[model samples]
Each structure stands twice: as structure tokens, then as C-alpha cells.
Target: MHNKTKLLIFASLLLAACSTDPMQEIPNRGDSAPEIETSDKICNTSDDAVAGSLIVKFGEEAIPSLEQNALNAAKTRSALTRSGIESVDDILNDLHVTSLERVFPEAGEHEARTRAAGLHRWYVLGFASEEDLDKAAERLADVAEISKVQFRTRLYRASDCKTYPFQATANGQTRALVTADFNDPNLFWQWHYINNADQAVATTSVAGADINVADAWKLTAGNPEVIVAIVDEGVKYTHPDLAANMWINPNPSPEYKNQDIHGWNFAADGPISWGQKGDSGHGTHVAGTVAAVNNNGIGVCGVAGGTGKGDGVRLMSCQIFSGDLTGDALVSSRAVKYAADHGASILQCSWGIKAGIYTSDNMFIKQSPMDYEALQYFAAQKNCEALDGGLIIFSAGNESTAMSGYPAGYRDYISVTSFSPDYLPANYTNYGSGCNIAAPGGETSGLSGGEKAGVLSTLCSETSNGADYGYMQGTSMACPHVSGVAALGLSYALEKGKRYSLDEFKTMLLTSVNEIDSRLGEGSKATIADVSIYRGKMGTGITDAYQLLMQIEGTPCLRVALGEVQLIPLTQHFGQGAEDLTYTDIQMSAKDMEKLGIKAAPKMYNGKLMIKCTKPGSAKIKVSAIAGGTKPGTGVVMGGMVITKEFAVIARSAGAANGGWL
Candidate 1:
């Protein structure tokens, strides 16, 4: 053949290889639109059809060239209207228009998004069909003010409605059931965390011999004044053991009569809703795990069992799931926001779904990898990143694959896979990503020598028509073990006179895990302090209650005075320091103090130093070595230190001695 003919043949072959054929690609889109599988059952209504319109986004390719362009354009409303564009929102939403974001030229600091004209402006437009996409592009071509048009696809998800048996409310008021009888040996062994007197009080269970509940017991047993929010399906706030620990939300919505819906109802249904007759009981069970009133000699004991000595970790339910919790991202996001805004340092989402469960079909692993997109969103929203420090712990999942579910997939999150003392990932548990870490989620019926991972916890059994605690398996059972440990960690951090961001807290939790010996290899371990220390299992060696408590006690408390950042570097010496030692560089400029609403200055009357807190909550205390290092010029804010003794008296009385000024 001639050279030209051979070249033509090669060209033809390349074209054929690049042909749009469904039989060739790994994930063939075929002739149809992209199939974005959502967690919700696709709604087949007219509304859904309307909602199916594609929402596109265009970035820098779609913003104004400069601030001059915006100023030069028609300034009058009529002129803009004539040009077919009214405002920014319209430009962002309308398909016919391409909206451009305008930036000012005289900005002092170059903002990342504002450096380029359209650099960071997100464009969102809707399209009903491919033909509509074409028309939208045509409109963009004709509009000078418009930059570019991009079409984007959105994923939709909803909740799954799985029903378990049990009344949602046990007493129609405050209280929740956290334990049950040991009638069923299988279940009894499973829930050994709940009523197992031997496990609760023993230094360790049969899993290993070194574990003890003393630290968890000490921290919460006396029922210290801590409040933990149980953000889950609405709790049966009326369960007997949980009432005392249930959080009362002082701030509630006007639509509801109760503000402390502390026990709340975020469900779509009402009091007489379909499942109200028998709540799934996941939340009640979880509440029991955190702070079920202990030693009532009735149902069961809690991680922090005290007559009310523990700082009450209030159970504030942000009902995300009715029971099944199918896999609703929007609902979960809203619940997380609610919990964070309402002062929940530790957020517990015990239930979840594996959104990516079928991408690949490896017979051995049997599930898809964790959803990266979903997990990213959760991690990004963690308040500890840019807001206040917080931690979110989720079960590694029960699919038995080497992958965790969404939310848990995010490394910023505490990914908790389950393991038994025998040293094995639960047969039904998920893992991989090496994810965050592993914990004792307990095992199912399958184990070597008939030995299984056993877990004791609160259960809401439908068999009795009311709430009851019991043992269970799966990472679902394993998640709370980690959550309880996280709570303990948070308390430890708080006592250290310091706070950790989400990343810091996650690091602490991961390192805190104890390892056990198992077939999963040397890396497989759970929290230490709970059992006989085993090696190579990946855990920190069982969550050591005593060791952790000692560690907390060892952390030096910062001696911060009111209205100042004083670096009192902790010394080996125990007990409070003498009154004469001064905390240097306190930010107490007249203007700074005044801005904080402090009318009185701490005067050095004779030899005593006195101060007062005029404001409630946490106020600022700035300190700096230099006279003008901080704003209004001077010091770093003294954020730690108890001020109740003096602040309480002043807050109640306008003229209360003002606490002896320095």
C-alpha cells in the first residue's frame, strides 16, 4: 500500500478507538444522562421532574473584567433592566444571562477570590434538557456582561424508612431506658457493656485482663456538670435512666412549646406520626451509652454512672433519622449544624449508610469505596477547623469491606472500625483508607473456635413494646465505644486548660487506641486500658481509664487572670500559686477595658489584687509583652480560668465590692 493510504488507515483506526460507544468505557454513560445514584428513592412526581433541571456552575471564566466594567455599565435600574440583567442573584440563577462578579481595584489586601475578574465567582444556572443547554449557551454568547455558562449535575438523596419495634417515648417526659435483662445469652454477651456487672466494675472483661472502666467511671460516675448533646433520632426523653442526663435546650423554636426540646423532634412526622408508636430506639440506646443514670440497681450502668455527679452530658436529640437513616446528606448536615450551634462539643451520629456500596464487586471485600465527596463535605463543616474545636466519631460501617462509609471516610473524622480482643476486624465491619482508627465495635456470630467479638450496650427492643438495653454487634455497636472514649478525651483536654481543634482531637483519639493481637496484622488495634495489653493489633492497647485520668490530672492548668493573657508556664510544683506572682503583659488599656464594658479598673489597694467580670459567658482578656502588640493595642486574650466566684456576685449586683482591685 502507498504511504498515504497507510496513514489514512491509521487515522481511521484512531477515530474508531475514540468513538462514543458504551461498550468500551469502564462506567459507560451510554446515550442517557449521567446516572447520579442518590441515597433517596427517586421521587417520580412532577415536582421531582421539575427539580431535575441541571444546575451549572461557572468560575473565573464567568466574572466581570474589572470594577471599571461594572461602573462603566448602565448604572440606572431601567438601563440594567433593558440590558436584561437586574442584580447579582439573577445573573447567578438565570439561564439566559451570564453574571459576572465585580471586584474593586483599591483593595488593600488581594483576596484569593478577587485577584482575577472571574477567578472565584461561582455561576449557577438551570437547564431542563440538552436542547436547553444549547439555548443557554447561545444567550451567553450574545450578552456582553456575561462571561461563560457551565452546566453542573447535582446528586439527590433521602432517608430510608426502616422500622424496628419499640415506643419512641417510654414515659411521655424526661428519662430514657439504657439497659435490659440477660435472658438471651447471645444478646446478653453482645451488650456486656450495659448490665454486665463483671465487665462494668471488673478491671477488664474476658477479652483481655488489663481493661478497667475506672477512668470513665471517675469522670462521669460522680455525674460532673458536663452536658453532652445526643444528636440522633428524637430520644425517648422519658426513659428512666436517661432523664437525669438528658440535656434541656434553654433555646427552643417558637413553633414548639418546649425550649429544651434538649430533647428535640427534627423528624418530618409529628407526635402521632407513623413510627411514634414504636420509635426505632437508636438514640435512646446511644444516650444510655453516654450517660444512663447508673447503679439504680434496676436496668444497667452507664460509662459515667453516678447518682448525678458527672457534669451532665445532656442528651440533645437533633433527630436526623426516623429510624432507618437511609442516607440523607442534607438532613445530616442540618443536624450537625444544629448540634454545633447549640454547644455540643462532642457530636454522636451512631447511625449511617454506606453511600458507595456497589461501585466495585470484589467478592472478598464486597462493597464500593467510601464516598469521597460526601465525606469531604462533613469534614469541611467541622467547627474545629475554623470555628470552635469539636470532634465527630462514626462507625467504620458494617459492610465487612475494607472501606468506611461517608462522614467516616473523612480523615478529619474519627473513623472507628470494630475489633475483638481476639484481634480481628469484625467479620461484618468495614475498614480501609487505613481510615482514622479502630475500636471494639464487637463481632457477629462468625469467629474462630466459636469465639466472637462481644459488646454490651443499651438497646430498645421491640419485643417488649418499651425501651430496654441489650447487646449487639456490627460497627454500629462499636461506634459508641469510641464516642464514649472521645467524650473522655474532650473532658481531658478541657481539664488541661486547653482546647484542641478537630484535627488535634482526632489525632489524640487515634493515638489513644490500644492494639490487640489478631489476623488482620500488626496494624490492627483498638483503644487501650480495657484489656490485657496485646501487641500488633493497632489499638492504643485498650482505652486506659486510669492512665488517661492520670494524664488529664498531670496536664497543668494555665493560671489566667481576668482581662489578660498571662503565661504562667506550668511548673512541677502542685497546688495553686501564691497571690503575689503577677501574670505579665495583660491587655488592660483604658479603651480595651472599656470596650469590654468594664467600668472599674483593678486598683492596687494595699497589698491585694482584685478583678471583676462584667460580662457573662467567655469574655476577652488580651496580653502582650509589648505595650501595643494587640488591637486597641496591647495583650493576648486570657480565655481560660474560672471567674464564677467574682463574676457571679457582680452580675447579680451592680455595686458588689467589685472583687478587690489590683
Candidate 2:
């Protein structure tokens, strides 16, 4: 009944998005021991800890007053009373602790939640750069008041792993005629979102290997209510293509208090900046993939980009990396927390902690608690009214290893692997456990597709070889397609008056995929070595946008085997006793038939429609049948209304076992 206890309980509830990041409980201990090093290695190498800095977590006895005084410059220094200061000072001796500050800022949105999570208990200690980091951490850990000491690890913005700058057309502008969904000149090159199979991303192409978002677009373009945070390089919010869909901070809370009205730039501790030297526009490219303004008639398309209707999912830049700026666990921890506080429902991270360092769950959790805690806080947030919790999506490392990188490999969040137009794993993509779903990440050497094989999107003019938009490839690019599809599913759920819990929504998102293992046996663009190696590594096939929406709407899918002929009974759509009713013919457009790879003109035989498909994808068909009458020209001219119903057909590979009716 106490007010303080009630506040703590409320705070704890916010981080209980689902469960703890740890697999099993860690036994509590306050002593500093040499054998069991708890401050996880911040990096994969021996030089893991920051030279002059150490992160310390104080116990309950020492945090109360420090928390109250952390925001006040003068009081913060004095808050560390004699006892606590003397204990730390005795161990440091000559290597004096220069400055002390809280690791995480004053969380306005969920201050109590941050405290209850023990983030407020964590502090950053700066000392002389010459001291041995491990010795200092051990010394601090010996203090009875300090429960944990962390050597903050620094993270680098790895090479984007992109192919040569590929322009769809001569001037980086598309001359192809604009399509119905978007007028963006370069939408034709975005085969990752909607693949007719004809758009060449590489030498070997599959007709329906994309995310299957074309039909999903008809249901809804995108809802501004959904926001995806790009937690990589700074996004150029002023770019012509991404400007409209950028998340604007109307109220500018502490999270958005920076100058870039679009989203805060943690990399610079100021406004979002994508134009610094060495800026690869990696974040800008990723932002465009997630939710660039569509139908703008200038640049490429976004997966959740509005259908020329100012309704795309909002893009929020949570910049952790800029030109030469490197981010660490402490920096990224704040970035992820800021994303949750500022109304972002999805966290799109194209990078992760060291790859291959953590092979098990326990090891990662023990070594990397800060990143884990921040991610948990982000995932636990309920930023959108239509969704119960948030989704954290990351790229499987491009290290060409068997296991995913840390964070993505952490198992609690979703990790995306890369596939090419041929429906096989990218040569550079990491495969194996921790990889959740696969998306088109493009390749470097598609003999025929050339540079166009890479995923194309808006680029920073600084890095686009003089163009505002360009192309890049990697699991980084693949991750956003999943994020965009998630945004689309949420948008559709909102329009249909539906609400879903985080787990339920994630289930639909992962299951909404086409089978890829079937085709993985044969074709590839970059190398043949990855074909067999990727057999079981790519997660749950391809992320299909249409299937996700269909599941959300409770729409049934009629499955058919690819490259096979089947006679479908008309009674399935009409009544079982269709003989009694006046029957008309079934009609399907040539375009619709082509979408499913159906070749023959639709024909009805003995109340059954016969058709064959050469591709694997989803399409809609229309059928008409009369009621209360024998035939159109027969008796009973005033028959009941002609009962017309539409059915959705999804084709699957007969050789593949994972796909079938929905």
C-alpha cells in the first residue's frame, strides 16, 4: 500500500514486455572475484574496455541520493558522500577517478521504470587513460556499495558490404513509365518488395522470390501511427525522398529535444546529421527502405512508403553512428531507450555487437547486460495504441559465419538474414541459428543484373557519387524490408479495427513468408558455395507482406502446388449444391493470372475450374454464380442476385515441404 512500492511496481511493469533477457537466474554476489569476470567484454577483442572509463552499478544504499542529484551539476559531484567516495578512492589511489556521470539520462517517459531496471544505479567513471582497465574495474568491484562494474565496449560501423553504386538508369533516374502504386521513378528496380520475377537482380531469378508486398499494398499503403526507428548512421531527413515520411517531433520531449526536428542524433549529441565527411548515407538508405515517401516521382520506393498518399509509416532517426563517430553499449543503450520514449513502435538496427564472440545465450547475457536491458526496455514499450508491445529487428551479421552476431543472436529479438533475387542466401550473409527470417539483401556479382543487383534507395548526396539516391546491399538492407512489412501489417490491423499482442503480431509476421528452401538447391548469383551451406540457415523462408495482412484479416488462402495442374471445385466459393442454381462462368484477368504464373485462359469443366501455375506467389480470382434460377436464358428470369465471391489463391512449390494452404 506504500506509495514508493506502488511506484516501483508500476516501473517494473513497463519492462515486462514479455520476460527477462536472461535464460536462467544469475546467483547474486557482491564480491570482486578474479575467476568470474562479470563485466562482459565490450568488444570481441582483448582491448575490449574503454581505456580511461569504467561503468559502475551502485547498490540500493548508494543510488537513492545519487539519483536525486544526478541532474544537478553542482549537487552531482557532492552527492557521492564521504563513505562511498572514500571506498572508491582508496582502491584507485594514484589513478584518480577524474569525473563521474550517470550512464543513462533522466528518462522522462518512464523514469521509475528506468530506476526499477537498475539503469539509474549505473554510472560512468572517467579516469586517466594510462591505467589498466581491468585492474581498475576489479578495484571498483571490490567496493561493497558497488554491485557491478562494466567496461563499456565500443562498437564500430562496419563496412556496409554494398556492391558498386548501381544506378537503375543513366542519370540515377528511371525512364520507365510510372506504375499504379507509386510514381517514384525507380520503383521498378525495387524487386525486393514486389518481384514479378522478371526484374533482374542477378543471373538466376525466381518469379516470386520477393516479400510479396504488391497485393498487400492494395489493402493499405502505410499508417503514420506506426513508426520504425533507424538506429544506425544519421538519416538525411531533408532528403527529397524521405522528408515527408520522417517522424516530426511536435512536442520535442527530452528525447527529441535536439535540433534535427526529425529525430535526435545521439552520434553528435545534437541534431540529426547525414552530411559529415565519410558519411556513407547508410542510415539514409536504410530509412528509405523502411518508409521513404512514395509516389513522389523522384527517387526509389519504400516498403511501407505510402501509395502516393502521405500515409507511410513514420521514419525516426536514432543515429548511433555518424562519419567517424563510433557508438558503444552505453551510447546505444540511451539511443534505444530514446526510441521507445519518442513513440517508435519498431527498432530497425542494421548492425550488432561483435559477431561469433557469443555462441550461447548465457554468455551473451552475462557479458552484455546493458544492451540487453536497453533492448528489453524498447521491446516492452507500448508506443502505438493498436499494438500491445514493440518489435526489435536487427540484421544477421555479414561475417559469413554460421551464427548471428550478438544482439541479433541474443534470441529474444528478431534477426534477419539476406537472400538474393534467386531466392538463395547471399554469399556474404551469415546463416545458421539466430537468423529468424530472410529478405532480399542483393548481391555484388549478379553477372547479368550487374550493379542493379543491389537494393536501391535514397542516399546521402555526400556518398551517392553525386546523386541523392543510390544502391547498397547487405543483411543491413534486408533488415528494413522486414521492418517495413511489420509496419504494413500494423497499418492494416489499424484500418481493420484489430488489436494484437506483441507475440501474436510477431507470429504473424514471421509466418507470413513464402518457401525459399525449395529453390535454394539450384540457383545463386555470387557463389555456389553458399547454396548448400544456406539450406537450413535462412529463417522461415521469405517475409511475405500479403500473407501477414491476410492472417490479420482472417482471410483463408487456397494453396496450389507450383508447376502443376489442378482442378478446383467451384462449389468451394459457391454453395456445395451449385447444380440447383443458375451458373455463370468464372472470370479472371490476364494480369491476375500472370501474377500467379497461370498460363491458360480460365475454363470451367463439370463445375470445376482447371488451371496450372508456373510460379509460387499469391493472387486473387473472381467467380460468378447465379441463384434461385436454372440458367441465365432459361426459366425464372427474375432469379436471385448473381452470387459473386472472390477467392485468394497462393501457389507453392510441390518439391518444397514448408508451404501450403493458409
Best by TM-score: 2
Give the clash count for model 2: 0
Per-residue C-alpha lDDT of model 1 across residues 547-657, encoded as one tens digit per residue: 333334443112222333222322222123323233343445674354334566543222233455333111223322222222232257733332111111111111112
Off by more than 4 A, model 2: 1-46, 68-85, 92-94, 156-180, 253-260, 522-526, 559-562, 566-591, 594-610, 614-617, 622-647, 651-662
Which lDDT value does model 1 have at 366? 15
Please list all clashing residue pairs in model 2, or write none if there are none: none
TM-score of each: 0.50, 0.83
What's the TM for model 2?
0.83
Poorest lDDT segment (10 consecutive residues) of candidate 2: 18-27
| Candidate 2 lDDT by residue in tens digits, 1-662 | 01222233333344334222132233233355323343432323226656787776665556534433332433333332222355655765556766666666655556766665666656777778888887777667666567666667776543363425545544222233113466776777776765555445554666566787767888888999999998988988889988889999877653334454777777678888877876788898889999888877787788898876789999999998877877777778878988887889999998877577788777776677667778887888899877899899989888888888878887678889998776677777888888899998887565467667678888887666667876788899899999999999999999989999999998889888876666555433347543666777889878888888888887755656677677777665566875445557667777878767787866566676677887666777766776666555437555455677666777755344433211
Tell me how candidate 1 scores on lDDT: 0.40
